[model samples]
Target chain A: MIYFDNAATSWPKPPGVTEAMVHFLEKVGANPGRSGHRPSVEAGRIVYDAREAVAELFHAPDPLRIVFGANATEALNLALRGLLRPGDHVVTSSMEHNSVMRPLRALEEQGVSLTVVPCSPQGFLSPPDLEGALRPETKLIVLNHASNVVGSLLPVREAGQIARRHGCLLLVDAAQTAGDYPIDVQTEYIDLLAFTGHKALGGPMGTGGLVIGERVPVDELEPLKRGGTGSRSEHEEQPDFLPDKCEAGTPNAVGLAGLAAGARWVLETGVEHIRAHEVRLTQQLIDGLREIPGVTVYGGLDATRQTAVVSFNVAGLEPSEVGLRLDEEYDIMCRVGLHCAPAAHRTIGTFPTGTVRFGLSYFNTPEEVETALEAVRAIARANK
Target chain B: MSYGVVLVPSTSHAIRAERVCHLAGLKVKLIPTPRQLSSNCGTALRFDWEERETVEQVLRANKVDYDEVHQLEW
Candidate 1:
């Protein structure tokens, strides 16, 4: 199967991922920090090693600041819901996942105002446009590192600088870019970063995190949950701290173990190489798809501006119908519909029907790309 | 091995549990509060031990207490 719907959740995770999870469940099954013993200590060791792996991958100075969650959506929820308050102003872009958009919209109930900067039709968000939307009351600027639908990467460093100039925090949803993209928290001045392990990271689902940078002051935001920390079992009140402030229960340790393994694999393999591989595959698909009559490819015209995702439409086929056909006849799997980012699709003028998105990954091969292209050609010809 | 369930009232309360797990060297997991178990927090921690009286002692010592310790099998 030519599995192209990786933006949703990557498939065929690294071989080591499941092994790591099983190892943890079988041998190191213990509640971290809930007790003091060999089992508990071993559990702590696993979690700590995971943190170190993440810290090393992202170049994050502190391992303690990396807070794990079920997925990027959950991490985004924690970052958005925990940090924003009534009367606060937030800025976002047209290219955000519903994971980021939905939570911010819910905050409207709290009187939090929002400004959504428009992106170029080719999927580029103009930092100047966002700067124009900035308010004196703007407390946070949320930017998706890459659009899940089109794979268009945003200019985060410039936008982060603007947020810093205004004393506002910059929150990045790195769902699509985390493992495939190299990011330095200090260099970009990003205050909060949310990443999922299921996508480019090649980890299993239910693994993601929110990185709280040193610059961001999150003290005022309320904890999403409160309970007995293994630390202060005697205290009924929940602890108010960074990871503790936002993290409220036992983490997804099995998923985290796999995610850590994935991150380590990315580090050892190098994101640059992964990125280069995807670019090569994407370009091949782009060239091949363009040759198919009645196929209209979408996203930035330049290959450098986008990642491995390629979105396009067949002239005569309904988006969903095309997806079904691809699966049934061509054995090609791709994502159809709004891709959970309606605004992005609307911005690209592909709302409702959305587009057929083929998201490539390092594991994909040149032969797979050629097969998908041939299948698209055959499908396009069927329309004739 | 030490065993306990660290219960929290809301989903957000797990952060403290995460901290305690990270700092105290415990294996922590976030599970929906088992309907059988009642607590102010809806999430509970399924700890990693068959027995550790000293683990409970440290929790009590550090003022980090739990709702109950059910010597449940893993």
Candidate 2:
């Protein structure tokens, strides 16, 4: 059986991910930073190691600047809600996942003004259009590194330069590109980077965070929830620090152990190597799908311009029907429907019907792509 | 031997300090912040008082965000 739903969460994680989680649960069953015992210290060290691994992967300046949370959604919420206040202006792109859209919509109701720059029909965001939407009160600009639906890459670095010139912060939702793409926070000028461990990072679920860059003001950012942070227990108020100010609960140490191992594997293997492999597979899939008579491919259709995800639709076949046939007959698993990014689908003109998405990963091979393409071709032919 | 403890703002900072000390060949351990040292009930990095100067230098070079330092009787 071929799995094509990696954009949701990667499966068959690299070696040591599960073992590290098991080791944490079995040998080091302790609440990290909540106690001063040896096991507790070891647990804290494990979580810190995860932070360091993620920091090193992204070239972040300090591990202390990383705040652990649930996933990219939670991190995005933290950055949006904590940083933006009433009367603040924010700008975003038309090609954004619900993670960014929902928060901004909610913030708009709370008196924060928002401007959404329209993207092209191919799901690419133009930096000039984004810069044109900026206002003097624009406090931050949130962008997704890549679209979860079509896998089209956004011009984050250009947006970063625009944000710099405008004296605003740039926040990138890297849920789709964190592990596969090379991102240097310093070079990219990303003020806030939200990443997920369960996706391309090859870690288990419930592990992800926001890496706060130096430009962001910690004093102004508020915590999503208030609780014990294993620091400043004497103070009734929260501790004003890099992570403690944002991290206020017992962290998922077990999940972090797996994340550390997964991130380390990505580092040792090199992101460039992974990208090269995925590019080959993505081009093969896109070329093969477009060759089918009734099948219509979506997005930029250029492997060099986007990620490994490919979206398509067959004439006279609904996306759900095509997905069902691929699973039952071809033993291929994929995701259909809006993919939680209605805005992106609408930008790409797939709106209501959405499209069948095949999200590839480093583990997917040329053979898998060929087989999936053949399956899609067969399904398209059957409809014809 | 009496030890000198380096107080940090958070557990993340304390763990970072301990890592820097170990890398510098200075043996250090994280202990509960001694009540006599500070009111902050967080982790503290304890080291031999004789290496107090070296500890200060290494932590400074690494830019570990330490709160303060105090010598504690063992």
Candidate 3:
């Protein structure tokens, strides 16, 4: 079977990822930082190494600021809900996944105002729209590094510059771009960033985290959860530390181990290499899919303004029906429908039914893409 | 065996969901949301089969966000 939904979650993780997970379960099985025993200490090291590895990958100056959660969506919630309060304003974009939008919408109902900058029909958010959206009450500018639907890359550096000028913190949801691109918190002036491990990082499904910049103190944001953080057990008030404040209860140690391994591979291999591979694959798909009649491809029509995600709609086929057909007929796996970013779908003019999204990963090969292309051609024919 | 699954969009939401679930006398194991179901999010909560009604009560009361619930048979 050919799996093309790497943007939602990448399967067939790197060799090191599964190995580390297996190694952790077999060699070390203890709650980290909760116990000072040798095994516990080792487990703690495993978690710390993953933290450090993630910090390095993102070029974050401090490792402790990295907080782990179940996925990027969770990390984004901790950053958004925790940092802002009543009367505060948030600036976001139309290209955000529901992970960013749902929480912001919840906050909006509770008195926090929100400004959603418009993205192009291709799902590209212009820097000027973001700049114009900012207000003195705008305490945060939250958006995605790449469109989860179309994988269009946002001008975060320009947006970051604007946020810094306005004294508003910038929080980027790197759910689709992390490990696939270079994110420097120190250089970008981004106060917060969230990434899921199962995507570009090639970690286990449960792995994801938030990278808190040194610019934002942990106490400024309210603790999202309070429980045994393996620190300050006696205090019922919750531990007051960066990771401890945000990360509650036992972490997905196995997932972390895999993330650590995946992160290490990313660092050694370099993100540029991954990007190069994806660009080639994306161009290939575009070239191939463009040949098919009655197919409308979405996002960065230029091909250079996007991540590896390519979304399109075939004439006369429901996105769901098309996805199921791909799975059944071609043994191909792809994600379809709104892709959780209803706003994005609407912005790209594919709302209601949405489009078929093919999330490309570095691990996916040209031959696999060719196979998917053939399947799409056949499906389009059948639909026509 | 019957199980209750708690649905959350992000891991952070799951963390809070688990707190609410535990308080509801429901034990939740974080399982990949059964893909047969449709969601904008990726995770789900599975609980004791017998305590489905109780878990649902807790989830609804605390507003522990969930997309859908299912009874998985073993």
Candidate 4:
């Protein structure tokens, strides 16, 4: 009954998340920004509130600059596809999720040159190595705040400084760290940050966005899709201002209502406190798994250096088999396989074979970690 | 009791304008954009015309982007 797949999506969301969505559906079910009616304005308020909450959480310059999208993947696409053009050079780390890699790979085919700075086998990206990958035409640098596979933190702030010195913008995919980590766009010099609400943000799916910093040229960044933005209806072309510039069509107001509540919960329960709790559980899980004779642990193995996710493999058993036994026999739910980050798997030396990942959250306690560790131990022993 | 309307880029801007105005102790409401103001189709913040200068100043102080401010007859 224990859920360890929080890196994919959090479960048992904080108190008001479900209630807010229910309230929106029951009382204020209306399309946001599409109409001028009272209910429409009210729904718009909910969506705007979600933007403000997400903005405040990241310490972004303005809420209006926070462009809403379906999830972090879409936001990453908006940043990568909107900003980069043919002949433009971009640099990224090898420890990136498919969200960043796939878009960049597609861009590479469209004449944009890409440089993937290799990370260590432990999935750590060195800032110097990243800076070395930059070219004269390097216009942007995209990096994940943390690796989704091993949960190893990247040197985003250092990379940001390097990017700024090179006259390049830094785009951070914070799918793994947002809400769970403290990120100040201004202080960190992050030009663009993509985040997800379903993961650590504790909200419903289909709610996430990108925070566009002041350095980005709004005029040049193109919209992913263009339609009625509920504003500038007279114009056949898209509106130049954000977020309407990036956001087109009716938004997911109900999902946003839940996002606002979930973000508020994270704010009330300070990120530092949440980070500390997750660190404790992560360290415990790592230590216990390493103690098992036939279990092979991955990543930095240091709680202070990474997130709550721990990836491992049992000897003589495939990751899929281990995952199935954990689910049906042990009643523990987790994710296995490449985790949609083949590049990261290659960096961590787990490509193709993959690994069993236990992504913990603030809601997970030491007791749950202990039980999961015992389950892993039993499985490993049986395989041995 | 005439009212002044502040036109903004989008509904998100209008919502921000209303929030900042309310925090500044000025009463404001989001109303349908009057056709005469601009061709942009979105909501506008309606406030007491007497507080026109104050509303403008508050919006500027709060960095809320507004297109134009006009006195409404309706």
Top candidate, metric DockQ:
4
Docking class of 2: medium
lDDT of 1 by residue, A87-178 (tens): 99999999888999999999987799988889987788988899999989999999999888888989999988998898999999999888
Lowest-sum lDDT 10-residue window in model 3 chain B: B7-16
User: For residues A151-259, what per-residue lDDT tens digits would candidate 3 score against the true structure?
Assistant: 8888888878998899888899999899887788877777888989989988889899999886786778887788876554445767566666778889899889999
Predictions' DockQ, in order: 0.04, 0.71, 0.01, 0.77
Superposed by TM-score, candidate 2 places the C-alpha of residue B8 at a distance from the truth, in angstroms, of 1.6
Worst 10 residues of 3 chain A by lDDT: A33-42
Q: What is the TM-score of candidate 3?
A: 0.83
Greater lDDT among 1 and 4 belongs to 4
Please identify model 4 stretches exceeding 4 Å from their true place.
none
DockQ-based ranking: 4, 2, 1, 3
TM-scores for the candidates: 0.84, 0.98, 0.83, 0.98
- By summed lDDT, the worst window of 10 consecutive residues in model 1 chain B runs over B8-17
For every candidate, what share of the true interface contacts is present?
Answer: 0.00, 0.69, 0.00, 0.73
Ranked by TM-score, top first? 4, 2, 1, 3
Chain A TM-score per model, please list them.
0.98, 0.99, 0.98, 0.99
